[model samples]
Target: MWISWMIIAVMVGIECVEAGLNTLTKVAMTSGMSDFVFVVYSNSLALLFLLPSTLIYHRIFLLGLLSCTAQILLYTGIGFSSPTVASAMTGLIPAFTFVLALITRMEKLDLKVKSSQAKSIGTIVSIVGAYIVIFYQGPPIMFSQSLPILHSPSESPLSNWIIGGFLLATSSFVISVLYIVQTWIIKDYPAEMVVTLIARVFVAILSAIIALIVESDPKAWTLRPDMELVTIVYSAFLMVTIRSVIHAWACRTKGPVFVTTFRPLGMVFAVFMGVTFLKDTLHVGSVIGAIIIALGLYSVMWGKAKEVEIIENSFICRINSSSEEVPLLQNKSIDV
Candidate 1:
């Protein structure tokens, strides 16, 4: 139907927009914009837009801390590595989320169930793929042939690449933790928009404090009249407002599974935009590792889908049995 098509279009558009902005941010940072300052500014702008939606806030400071930490790590990783690396690392979130859920007792692990076994195996495979990407650069499949100026200074060293990879991985893990916490918070505070606004406020304030401490140069807070300003405005309006609204709508209309199913597409967009616009090289190890991660991600998704299906089926059967028992009890009463 049209609704399904629209959802697909918007989800793909969201991924493309995210990839483009990531590339733009990298270019802006490469042009002397401080990563810390960028995070502070973008989040501050987001706060301005979300101010009108402020409804309530509970004891959710931890949400802000996690989000701020994740943003700092993510942006710093982009500065050290490339958008492609950041996108590739996102595939690890589900794997990390599953593991954390088990640790938190939010999810159970049953070795007898094939679904749980698949999730466990998928987690291991995802971790292995992450290691391979971090430890091995291999040869360039697509060398930088244009936009020579965009080549990241940090990318010249293997150690920086490894560090960037770990930072990105940690960022994804932090986001997974955020997801888990968000679920808990939603039980008490059902207003997602309010929770998001509160979290953004926290991120803005926290990031600003950190920026002031690390980037003491008053000039670092000053925005350039060029791409820096553009990136901030774009992030504030499109990334913060439009993207969030679309994702929330999609999740409510379809389901989280429908939204998450499109996540892998982000890496494709990142690779295309990075290679084409930023003239980033495609490394063999990154490709191989990404493919491996994708495989594991799909495996985990399948297991999750199966588990959900089984749970739904069991609930339906229970309801039907209860209904049948109700009729038999009524008949016995009538006979009496």
Candidate 2:
């Protein structure tokens, strides 16, 4: 149990780092490069860093396919939408994962089961909160800026950006599927090496495709002595490779739900950093939505805890029954 708590702590820490890296990546991409170029370069660098590990593990194919597909969709969505919007949409990943797991019968749902009930209610609540965050524009707060810092003085209309936000949300859904599949694979495989290797290979292929499509200029390949490039490298090598390895290790030690529960912790950290460092204005509705999200996250965790208890008890009972049967069989043979 102590070890489990430690693993969860590590997962939360990793997620926090991920949020920071993601925030930095968005800033870097806004510099000059096309979104496609940023995606390609980021993935390529990650692949280069992870190649050796993948070769060592020999699970290059499976991991590569899954990671590449997910990353491609994720990057494409990011290219289309605001980072904040994208992050908010990604908050729905847990709900998507839960629904998928239920559909596949990987998870059982019963009204009589308190955990299941909690999870169901939590998922619905979190989704509702997300919609409120996205669609609601309450009375202008005192701090409400006339213009968003991220947007140019002459920016596109909000209605025009709806498609981009929707694309990002769809990307989040696809990512959740990949995460679920990866979790299932990790049950039988060494997750660290497998995930690292696959990410490297798949991202390599993905980057090459993006480069061919968007970066026709040879100058795009030239390395610039820019801080943004450094941030991208850090995101690729440390955030993608090192942190991911740690996350997989934690998941193996603690279970996927234990790791997943800490996801919202990232959002909390992101909000804090955004307000402090980026000077992003927060609205009353956004604050309320965030609180609701936290509540929903807690509910999901509660449900998952109950599910884990049920599974543990079932395993214990089976083990005890098997032990009893073995002793009885041995006693009968001795009498004979």
Candidate 3:
């Protein structure tokens, strides 16, 4: 139980870091720096820091490749979309993951199983909720009688912003796949070493390529002291590496489900930050949509717990039966 709590706490912390990073990135875009430049520098620096340890683990290349692709899609998406829209779309990740798992036969759908049915229903409901949030801009209801907060210049909708948000959501789905693959591969490697190496090397190469294509002035690569640099470094090192390590440790001690179930905690943190720091406004529709999303998340989690309990009970029964059989055999030998 203690371990479970630790996992939840770590997941929550990671979510907070993610939210804060999003906020920082939004601010950076509002400034003169292009998303391409931001990605190049931040990832390049991260790669530099991670190279030594990654090589030591001998998994720098593979992990780097996967991480690079994920980052490119994600950063590009952020460059194109508002952080609020991007973050909300991320709620679709679990749904995407479930579909992928089914396609890959990593999980199965059994209509007869209550847990399975619940998971399927919950996933569908969550998807519907996301669409409602995204497209259903109905008449605004009064939440707190507050005016809507204005977005920064960068955050203002370009013709491509909607496309970018969709792309970002897709990027997140792809990254989740990479995560699943990493889990399979990391069985033979250290998580820290693998993650660090990938962040450092692979992403650096990818970002450099993007910089060349996107930035008009090659001089954008020149380093200058600013809040963006600080934010990037903090995000790359502390948020990406350090917090990830902590979360991995907690997940190992507890379980993946426990960690994953706490994902919504970050949403709460993001909302608070959005309101206070970014000065985002809330409407009744958005509020109601959030509540629905939360309920859907809970339903999915409950289904997962029930499934785990069933598996554990079956294993316990098997062990007990095996033990009883061994004792009976010994007694028969003694009597003979």
> What local distance difference test score does each model get?
0.75, 0.66, 0.63
**Residue 299 lDDT in model 3?**
78
lDDT of 2 by residue, 281-333 (tens): 66666667778877887787688778879899999999999998998999999
Q: Model 3: clashing residue pairs?
A: 47-200, 64-198
Query: Least lDDT summed over 10 consecutive residues: which range in candidate 3?
Result: 141-150
Between prediction 1 and prediction 2, the one with superior lDDT is 1
Off by over 4 Å in 1: 1-16, 57-59, 123-144, 152-155, 241-265, 283-294
In the range 1-336, model 1's lDDT, one tens digit per residue, is 577678778887997898788788888888889999988888789877877876566556898899889888988998888777787687677566666667777678899999888867766666566556545779989887758557654445888888888999899889777767766666555666777777777888898899989997888888889989999888877776677656556545543433544555567677677677777777787677768766765676577668878988999999999999999999999999
**Considering only N, C-alpha and C atoms within 3 Å, which residue pairs clash in candidate 1?**
none
- Highest TM-score: give the candidate number: 2
Query: lDDT tens string, model 3, 4-88?
Result: 4555566667878887887777677656556677766776666655666555544456555666666667667766776666666
Using TM-score, rank the candidates from best to worst. Answer: 2, 3, 1
Model 3, which residues run further than 4 Å from truth?
47-55, 60-62, 136-158, 243-269
